[model samples]
Target: MCNLIGHALQQALTRRGFIAGSAVGASLIAPMMCSAVAGDDELDTRIEIAQSSGDTASSRTRLLLLGTAGGPTWWPNSDQCGISSAVAVGDAYYLVDCGEGVGKRLQQALLPANSRVMSANLRALFLTHLHSDHTVDYPNLLLFGLFTGLDRPASPLKVFGPGRRGQVAPVFSLPGSSSPTAPIISPDNPTPGTKDMTGYIYQAFATDLNDRMRDNGKRSLEALVEVHDIDIPQIAGFKSPNETPAPPMEPFRVFEDDRVRVSAILVAHAPVWPAFAYRFDSEDGSIVFSGDTARSENLIKLAKGADILVHEVIVTRWIHGLFPAPRSVAEEGLMQHLLGAHTPVEEVGGIAEAAGVKKLVLSHIVPGNATREQLSPAGKGFSGELVIGRDLMQIGTGQAAAPARKG
Candidate 1:
């Protein structure tokens, strides 16, 4: 039955064309990529249902596994190239990187009820960096939030990330596109970067807001969407090649309300400078979401002893083996970037061990095409509890508030 189920799941994954370039030795490898039934619409309904039942806890410190696989470049099917990102539930809704399909995933997980993520409430979007796969949904989230009524004048939202004026503006508000161009995001510093993507995201939404309000009855687009730029690299540290001049790292505190507190630090995801990892500490427990990074001591320092370290992982051996011969030089060349850009399974374990974290949630799993053995490399290296995350999988941190243990 397990084999049959695996076969079925493999078929579903292949139909989506999310397969990798390598050929698998067995059907078992195929099952790793299963169909995630809960799309954004579905999640939205669930949240609405949960809220209507007076279940505020549903929107509490719960972590919703929205998009687990990375880099397929499309939606759930686009698993190959995308990096991992997630939605964290707190007093207000907080989005980890808005990767590909994240808007839809958020839509599926939010909306419908009079909850915090309804038509006009947003906690903030915490970003690790500006990788295309990790940030593809930036424009979508901004546009959808406004279109779906989630973003309105009264419900200004926020987007946080490392600042890069040249890279962010194009995506935040496309040049010559109908969207409103924002004031340069990132802020003044000796490092030379923007405030954050918030301003640019809002500027992009401006044109959409005008069209929506003029077309519909909604008034005041600015009220609906608000942007708070966070200079990540300045506070954290920018990773760059030693031979080249490195952009100064900027890491800073984003928010610290009674409900949750967020802090960031820079990590090494070279060539692509100014990457980050965020630590969201709440009363119940804490979670550290690594944006997209190779191995880094900096990340371990930031995540020390946290309940969950939501980090990205890749199969180093399998990736290297895929193009092992002289004939596959081109393929090997391509793998180098991915291999070097992401953390290997053993590295994840090492990071967890060094940080003294009790649990590790491996996400943004790369080459979603690897065998089960290859896919779950982190499990073998770490003795502490480890989770090979799947979309929609929820990890609980605090003990289910129970009656006091009878002493």
Candidate 2:
């Protein structure tokens, strides 16, 4: 089953795709790839319906998992939504990583009866990186969200993400495969960060935005969103040597408000430079997000002593099966990047243990159909609680309020 699923997903992830090439459009073919290799339809239907397996607790600070699947593919046999999460403190909530399906998930997670808007209580949004899986629905958040009260916030909705990489990422080269000479996309500005990407999105939807503002009198999206590119602080040993750079560093402040103090540290997701792990400290407790990384000491440092650590996990067994033995040099190169950039389930527990976190919740899981036991290796070396995250699942990070007397 594992090999079948991995191979199904590999069809979505080409040996020369995503990691090595700047082919964001390649992800558009993911669903077709998944369908081409999808297994029994009846089995797929059963699992898809059974995956939403958790509920929330009443507390001042809570962690909500909006979606848990990783990668660009919409896995065929899975019910999980894309990778997104929220931290609710009192009445307002902060969001991290707006993946596909975020809108529907947010509505289920926060929208009240007779209410159509999900942004009324949303305080801010933070992006860990520019990966398509993480930011695919971002434009939807700003466009559709406007009708759902995104434009009604007392102040502009704050958004922050990595700044532009100084240069375009070099193409991949293996010993006996294709040349690294593929033509670049958007050559003039091959790599734009959060602020630039947001502007481009607005422009792409200018007709809709303009019509809404002129005909419907909706607030200008320009006036509703405030986007900022997070500036990286200097790191002593960091250098981009024909590759992306991530060096040892302190967690620098990225945002703050009366509810939470947010700090971030660079982690190793090479070729995807400026990837970050964020920590949110509130009066209730601390929660950290390991954006997408291999075992990172920088992440361990930032999450140290936190109440919860939400991290990404990929199945090593899946990788092994995804690329069977007797693979080509190019295949091996892609495999290596997949292994290096993502944390294996076996090692994730140790990362949580090293950070002294109270609990480790795994999200952004690859091969989204993986079962609980398949993901259980994440608890092998950790003493803390190990949670296999599910969409709509909620865990309290702060003290829960006492129940009102029934009488």
For model 1, the superposed segments whose C-alpha errors exceed 4 Å read: 1-60, 72-91, 110-121, 152-155, 165-208, 219-223, 232-252, 321-333, 399-407
Q: State the lDDT of candidate 1 residue by residue for 1-407, as single tens digits.
A: 00101122223223211232113312322333443223244232321111122222332465655676665445444333244354344435677876666755454444323223442445677666666777777777666665565645544565566655333322122235465444652445322322444455557678776777788766553565555555433333433333221333433567776767888876767656566788888877888887678877778878888987888887788676667666343464467667777888767877777788876776787755444445444755565666555543445465343333436
Best by lDDT: 2
What tens-digit string does per-residue lDDT give for candidate 2 at 1-407? 11111221232133221222223323433553454335555434322211121113446787877878999889877777899999988878899999888877777666543466678778789999999999999998889889887877467899989888867766667656556676788888888999999999989999999999999889988888999999887778777723436677899999999999999998898888789899999998999999999999999999999998999999999999999988776797789888989999999988998999987888999878776557767777887776667666567766654453446
Worst 10 residues of 1 by lDDT: 1-10
Best by TM-score: 2
| Whole-model alpha-carbon lDDT for candidate 1 | 0.56
Q: TM-score of model 2 relative to the true fold? A: 0.84
For each candidate in the order shown, give its overall lDDT on alpha carbons: 0.56, 0.78
Worst 10 residues of 2 by lDDT: 46-55
Listing every candidate in turn, what is its Cα RMSD in Å to the true structure after a full C-alpha superposition? Answer: 11.6, 9.5
Backbone collision tally, model 1:
37
